[model samples]
Target: MLRTDEILSTIQMLHAEHLDVRTVTMGVNIQDCASADVEAMCRKLRHKLTSRASRLVETCDRVGGKYGLKVTNKRLAISPVAHLLSGHDLNAAVAVAKTLDQAAAEVRVDLIGGFSALVHKGISSGDKVVIDALPAVLSQTQRLCASVNAASRRAGINMDAVRLLGEQIKAIAEATADRQGFGAAKLVVFANIPEDNPFMAGAYLGDGEPEVVINVGVSGPGVVSSALKRRLELEPNLTLGELAEEIKLTAFRVTRAGELIGREVATELGIPFGIVDLSLAPTPEIGDSVGEILQLLGLDAIGAPGSTAAVALLNDAVKKGGAFASSSVGGLSGAFIPVSEDAALADAATRGHLTLEKLEAMTSVCSVGLDMIAIPGDTPAETIAAIMADELAIGVINNKTTAVRLIPVPGKKAGDRVDFGGLFGSAPVMPVRNPGASSRFVRFGGRIPAPIQSLSN
Candidate 1:
């Protein structure tokens, strides 16, 4: 703990590799804010959120500045809005969403998550309200994010919920077509969704969590890549096993740094520190890509034969490092490969080096599934459901977290470019090999039984 060289090395790496905490997310349990009356419920939501998170931004900045670190985003996640919307109608759902946007804006947070529904087994009335209102909710709100859990190991997959979400995603895109389907980017469909995820579109305060908590997302694909590159420069013949060890060490430092900052912020805010999500979340920025790390790991192309294995190695090393660094490592603590958000992956997709099928295979190993990938607007709802069914099947069978964040850009076709700009980035729409071929399969809609793994005692 007293090694000056280690401290200096950490400092150097922070600046040199563009390392910074990705997000400081404050989770507030708002289940107490529920009411049958729409206006009263919205009022409670506003008061609860504002009172709980008013100082989140200020605290993140002050704490980060103390350590010469930058907290890229200060965000908020509430308990599932579905609970608050129970016994409410679609209009009430819209009202709750608007209230969230307003409250988050007033508190000056970047995004507000937890507009979510857990429909893994079946959709409750509240879940239905949230689902039905998504097209309007997403189209009209800027800072609001939503998630729907349609699959889980214990409950199998809710094909009904999946089919609804597939259709609604199209509706959401057409509702916001003027913005090139950017609204769909704010939604994530999940299997075995995490309660404390600090990442956007999927974050929410799950049941049994504390009343209020602070979670941090430390994303360092760039940092990991830089360390690998430096090591390779010195010894060009190091084996993949050796490289994974290096990744673990680098992840250890990153996780420690993240937890340090997150705990400090939590202490200042008078709430418990939740976890450090050590996911290697990437951006469109050059040098800050997960795909670049894959390239550095001797993959000539991202979606080649060895891509899945490389991702598995990276994801495993990261989890091991984070687990060793902190007992508080939760959320999706692995390497992310969101296509549009990672420039290298996006370029690989544009160049035909990556395809939907390849991306699905990699998600079997990576942290998240089919993230930020755009497809033709004309893609069938049944096909979208099939895509989700396949990814969720992976999670349900393996008992891990996997999600889909696909955008079907209106009026766009496969191979056409759709620029969402900013961190949402852009991608050339990838073709769904057989658009409506899966209609019958997805149409035979019933729960896909959970694997025998669910019975493990």
Candidate 2:
């Protein structure tokens, strides 16, 4: 039970800080909707999603309004579409994506995920079809987001899938050249991807998830930043250790708020409540930034020498607090540093303080990797794959979840600006170092075996 004073304090946070439920995603498993007949499958999928998610937005709004808190985005995540696309052609794969887009529109959700494939070991014929159709499917759809799991601790890295995705990303960028490769922004490639994540571009209903569940994403980078500021004002002599504790305690409160809101909405919808993902997901707004939190933690810039250490500390503390606060905590519940989505991180990139190398290093300790980063138009596909391979390697070896959402902006060179607007935000195209140098390495398309540590069982 939440104390009256705690509720009041949470209300204060809503007004004083950029505190809000980032997303309430309904994961609807549609594996049962699969059919060899493409038309039949599409019909079943459309009906299922629409019927299941029909009341999602209304319920979220009603619950949030009751508590005087806003649910920023209402979303949906389905079981991997590729799994349902078995025995289907590329054309059928694309049609399924369009169907998903239509369902999301009818339900009025912010985004719909699970146009995904798990190819950590190898790509299936169905997965191959989905991958091939991504350029057109992503360019044609607005609400549909896609993800591919190309690496995992047990299966290591599927360089074949990585190679294919690199080419597909390039094709998707070209397909959406009118929008400066905005299509790539809707796609993520992952290593050890989580099934229960409520965030877009990476969210998917994992095979083990319930037929229907509601996962809540809680974001409070601004709240965390503001708390640190107040604490420093009160105790100017506090050390880093003490500051970490403060961040942890604040995260606990944030997680609790999310859990309370999530359970209420789930109960109202008659759906089982999922986990609270306490990720310090930032926004383009000036104050609501994970980068700002880093600055408050004594970094002059986000890509500075001590940046990785700062991120490691922040991630550890967030996970610890979230775990303690909610036994049902799941998903990638840590700080996200998407370059374009966070204004400070974008500025850091423009200032040359946040280079690709530095960002990659930061991903080793952060929630996700290489997110929403735009590189020069001419950057080679092999370079993009190499970047993904490096990030995935970290996750595979460390047994963590990491992902890449790199957009090679079409017709844009290094230092050129491109605006995706809305939640997608904008960023200057950063140059890929030694652009074509990794072609030979990436061309070795095969599997990289799992490390010995994967034998933990």
Across 211-283, the per-residue lDDT of candidate 1 in tens digits comes to: 9999999998989999999999999999999999999999999999899999999999999999999999999
Clashes of each: 0, 0
TM-score of each: 0.98, 0.98
For model 2 the local lDDT of residue 98 reads 93
lDDT of 2 by residue, 1-457 (tens): 9999977767668978989999999999998898989899999999999999999999999999987888999999998998888788888988999999999999999799999999999888788888989998999999999999999999999999999899999999999999999999999999999989999989999988899999999999988998899999999999989889989999998998899999999999999998999999999998999999899888997799999999998998999999999999999999999999999999999999999999999999989999999999899999899999999999999899999999999889999998999877889999888989999999999999998973665
Q: What's the distance in Å from true for residue 149, model 2?
A: 0.1
**Where does model 1 exceed 4 Å of error?**
1-4, 454-457
Assess each prediction's global lDDT (C-alpha) against the native: 0.93, 0.93
Task: Give candidate 1's whole-model lDDT.
Answer: 0.93
The TM-score between candidate 2 and the true structure equals 0.98
